[model samples]
Target: MLLTSRSLSRLGHWAAGLLTGLVAMAAHSAPLVMAIGDSTLFAPLQLAAQEGFFAAEGLEVQVIGCINGRRCLKHLTDGEAQVATVADTPMVFALHAGHRFDIIATFGSSSRDTALVARTDRGIAKPADLAGKRIGVVRGTSAHYFTNVFLLVNGVPRDSVNLVFIDPIRGAEPLLRGEVDAAGLYRPTGPQALEQLGAKGVQLPTLRPYTVMVNLVAQPGLSQDTLLRLLKAAQRGVALLNGQPGRAHELLGARWKLDARHAAAQLDGYEFRLSLDQTLLSTLEAESRWAVREGLVESRAVPDYLELMRVEPLRALDPRAMTIVK
Candidate 1:
């Protein structure tokens, strides 16, 4: 009787284990997530995907690379993607257009990662010098905003410079070939431009710390549970990227085929502040105010930017990790 009872107990334990496995498998079969972004955002997605971080969280992510923030917004608006990594300007535009989305989190925080590159022969050493010159910039992008602010604050009239719209990825080519006098490009591309054409670039000094370039946005009505899972996974990925940069660089280099020095330099200058910082909030407020005054958005209809931002997941994962303003 004792032996028979022990065998039955063992069988029951196996049955419970099987039940748990089934439940786990069912949870893992949830709908896949779609992510859209440019190269900067794409790198982390690729790393997360390659590292099984998403899968471990029971998420299947489909990452698509768009040319710029505008295209990223289009992808989200067109229902081509459910989530996107973009800049503050595009997010503001989407909010004004009445798109129901939330700024989930930010990856980069500084403008140092981006620069205004000019031909060495052009003798363009400062933001003011770009006046009256045709500068290639992706209109409606963070780069565009930076360029506008840099010029205006430096006493360069908005009308003094001719603005030309160009794809950020291909913007350098035109500038290198003398099609445009200067180009606004991110670090990776900026480094590539300097290496390829020996172009000189100037980093703009702005009131706010030039960090927080990329922000992760999600479509409205994402279930709280799902959003929490994604935030957790992303936080995990961010921790990896920040803590183990060499491994991060290795992964990025393998995918982008970037040289070690360029990749390291890009990583070094990038401020991947996972949590929303005071500087970012202040910058967003200032940018929004500027946008309203400059007729970018209706002042009366300006939504509470804080409402459009969701940081609960980050707070939930590690309460001490983020210092939310309010």
Candidate 2:
């Protein structure tokens, strides 16, 4: 049927009103998240914001920098940030301290991300040689835990070594200057230190059980809608990272001042990812035990990990992708 002028005008008004409503929904529904992720090599949350992944998912994510998981947790607890990317070790401490958070997603299991780097010239040709040597480590971070576990597994006594607590970012210098016999460091700085140390540097083995899984967490009271948006954005961000690593690396280098090639190398070792499952919860429970023994936490009872995980957001997207919440 042919439309008359009056009907056509009515049709235009309806179209305009519908367009206005859609815009309003996108505006009001989009959650403004003050999200902090890895400050160094790890870059999922940063990539999402840079690549427009968050915007595509209708989320307004503000990326901030924190030195490590513990600092990220501090940002969340201090109300400086709404969401954060933290690892299991510090989370063990935070939880034991009575901070309530809902871990919405897990990033990945990475081995090259953290390690114990030693200077061969310090007469430390082996992990056991680390005994009586001064070691630079950042306390309450993954490297700190890795250092302790590495020493334990390698049969080095804690009392035999002198632990010098220093920031990971500043670790490479001290090792090069012979200020510390070795340094416990993670990617970027870790790799860079080894490169600078050349044949003089040695990478000791890492404890697989300590599986430092970087996770996205938020206050327990975070709205389900916002959590879902974060999940959507994170999934897309991981896809892009894997699908076109060159472009991702270039962007990361230009924006974050990281070397593209080094970033690519770093990315290979990490699983820029998303998950809320039994595998992750099981890991946390195991870490809790280790944490308590290491004096990282005082809780004799492992907080029921399931209570801290909010799986509905991830489940809503892909039930098969997430484990059944018990």
Candidate 3:
């Protein structure tokens, strides 16, 4: 959680100092970032703030939690935030719309980040059971891609099912009320669905090749110095998470509104290794193709994602983990 014991004093101090007009956020704070709100995809970045990882790097990050990637992108585009956190799927779509930015780091995964949940009584015991059924998802987003990919990988033709576009927040509600046969939901909404349906809810298997890549994006011309400091802090955050799973799980439970056991269980579903690897490249490429094919973008051409990746920060932080893309 970003409000952990180690982080309270700094945040509280900032809050308390606001009345004096001393919180010159733009002048005093290190660059600001708008991260997806309460989204599991950006946990590493949140952990970086909560565990004093950013402070250890001599950087003061004023983090704003936006509700989703689209909003985060807005913050970056409008110059309200120096950096933004979003998944690769939306990143590709935004790029197609001419959002000039560079990917600084890739973190998190979709191993269990997205799930195809079915109401047990719907008789969706197998992947093929979804044919001709209604599957709800928030259209043109990661959940949308997950829904199609889930069906395609499972040999359930995309056209065989009815895809109803619904907001992810209440996406599961329809399923619980027997409004939709199934839904493509992501945490923490997936857990909400499971809680509502109990034994009646089943999460479909995650498609490894289709895992979503969470990334940090910065508006053009961000300083190399600033980028490196932020990444060094993030790198430490990853180490802390790996070194202290017990404490990490406790934090996750608080942030995600899950029990300790549930938090631990959810922890296994993601890999928080921040890097700009072939995995990220391939995922972006695939998502671009899907976005274009689905008419989600105005341009049919998929930009060279490599050019969008800025590797200097990661290379400086750990050259051993950096690989030449071309």
Q: Which prediction has the highest TM-score against the true structure?
A: 3
lDDT of 3 by residue, 1-326 (tens): 45787689888887888955665554555555645445776777778878778777777677888766666776887778888888777787778888789889876676678888888799986778998899888765677788878887778887788888886556478888888989988777777798889889887664443577777888888788888988887777677667887887788778877777788777667888777788888878888888887777899888988988899988888877676564
How well does candidate 1 match the true structure in TM-score terms? 0.81
Q: In model 1, how large is the Cα lDDT of residue 294? A: 63
Selected candidate, larger lDDT, 1 vs 2: 2
Greater TM-score among 2 and 3 belongs to 3
- The better candidate by TM-score, 1 or 2, is 2
After superposition, candidate 3 runs with Cα above 4 Å error? 1-31, 205-209
**TM-scores, all models, native as reference:** 0.81, 0.83, 0.84
Q: Write the per-residue lDDT of candidate 1 for residues 1-326, one digit (tens) a residue.
A: 45698899999999999999999788567555555554664456556667878778977777676776668777887887877777787776666667778777776666576667777567777667787798887766777777777676677788888878886657578877888888777656766787777535444444443444577788887766777777666776777778988888877777678765556766665656466655556667767676677676654366677777787866776666466566
* Model 3 root mean square deviation, Cα atoms: 10.8
> How accurate locally, in lDDT, is each candidate?
0.70, 0.77, 0.77
Question: What is the Cα-based lDDT of residue 260 in candidate 3?
Answer: 72
Write the number of the candidate with greater TM-score, choosing between 1 and 3. 3
